[model samples]
Target: MTTHTPTTPEQLLEKLTALGIEATTINHPAVYTVEESKAHRGDLPGAHTKNLFLRNKKGKMWLLVCLEDRKIDIKLLGKALEAGKLSFGSAARLMEFLGIEPGSVSPFSAINDREGQVKVVLDTQMMTQSPINAHPLTNTMTTAITPTDLVRFLESIDHAPEELDMNNLAELATKAE
Candidate 1:
């Protein structure tokens, strides 16, 4: 079996351009959480994202992206997705599948999943917002792209997401909140 070479941040940006996606990226200190990212984003417009790499007991993997501040309950989310008790995928599984580390998880990393092993999930509320901000397969920079372009990029990589209706997900957030 041939190993898939991991796509770098520069390659991700090039792919965005090749697809006619107008995106902006800015360098910043590496941020491991939503709160830490806010200080570094510096007025970057659009919806900021918090990405979760999850796995079920059966080995099903999911890349779930939502608003940075949104509350999430893993059990509720697992029930909603019928994923059977989902938990965070380990760093080793993350690297093997998405070619990214824990702090750098993003839908863009799906580009590296040649076998399409991960199920991508996006929050509907975030989908409605433009210029979505996420890491471009790394934590040291933030890339901004329109929602349409974001979906286009995912589709280009054959990783079209299962859009989660946040109106329904709000109940789960309420439980956590």
Candidate 2:
């Protein structure tokens, strides 16, 4: 069997092109923290995002997307979203399931979610933006695309999310820093 390179931001853009979703990307230094992402935002226009890769107590994986600075409570989140106890997914699972690494989580990696095993969860507010910014498949780069394009891509990959007002991540953000 011929092995192919795993999904990258550029590759995702190409895939989007075929799907008729016009998108663009910006390459930046590897950003492991959300605060670092803010530095790049001034030059990049659109809705910026924060990505969370989580797992339930039973090991079910989920991808949560929201605006930067929102706080999230895992316990309250579990209760509100009915996810049954959630925590960050392990590095091994990140690679195996989403084909990404720690500190590089993004909804775009949903492309690697070939089996449709991981569930996508988005904050209700993010849907209001026309174009949004997110890591393509790595934290080192960011991509900007319309919400319509994002929804289309997610649908194509079969990971269209369930929107929830369950977690207030702005608090989490303040505490983290």
Candidate 3:
């Protein structure tokens, strides 16, 4: 079997440029978690993202890009999306599907999903915020782009994303508690 090469941050940036999407990138020490990233953002004005690669029992997969501060409940989200028994996709599966590792999960990684196997979801609240910040396929740098440009880039990769109100979903979950 032939091995596949993963898209590097520079290549992703190049794709964005080819799509005429203006984005700014900032480099920092590699961060493995959202909390760890907080110390590096400085005063970047925009909504930072927390991404999740999830799969249901049937092999259906989702790539969720939401506001960094949004709290997600897997069970409730499963029910909401009709994606029963959702679980985090394994590191191997992440690489297989999106050509990314656990910590580097990114909606931008959709470029690697040439088969369009993963459904991409962008947070409504997060999308409303300008200059959406996300890893450009790695955790050592953040690429910032206007929400419109982000969607344009995703669409350019044939991975048009669904925008959902994740904040409202979180609110509903809280009320149920």
TM-score of each: 0.93, 0.87, 0.92
Point out the worst 10-residue segment of candidate 2 by lDDT: 168-177
For candidate 3, write residues 1-177 as lDDT tens digits. Answer: 235787888999988888888899989999999889998888988999999999999999999999998889888777667677799999888889899877888888988888888999898889888989999999889999999998888888888998877867756445555
RMSD of each: 3.2, 5.2, 2.9
TM-score for predicted model 1 compared with the true structure: 0.93
Residue-wise lDDT of candidate 2 within 57-116, one digit each (tens)? 787788988877777777766656566678988898888888888877888898888878
lDDT of 1 at 98: 91
Question: Which model is ahead, 1 or 2, in terms of TM-score?
Answer: 1
Best by TM-score: 1
List candidate 2 stretches off by more than 4 Å.
1-5, 166-177
Residue-pair clashes per candidate, as listed? 0, 9, 0
Give the per-residue Cα lDDT of candidate 1 at 34: 95
Q: In model 3, which range of ten residues has the least summed lDDT?
A: 168-177
Ranking by TM-score: 1, 3, 2
Clashing pairs in 2: 69-170, 70-169, 70-170, 71-168, 71-169, 71-170, 71-171, 71-172, 72-169
**What TM value does model 2 have?**
0.87
In the predicted model 1, the residue pairs found to clash are none
- Best of the two (2, 3) by TM-score: 3
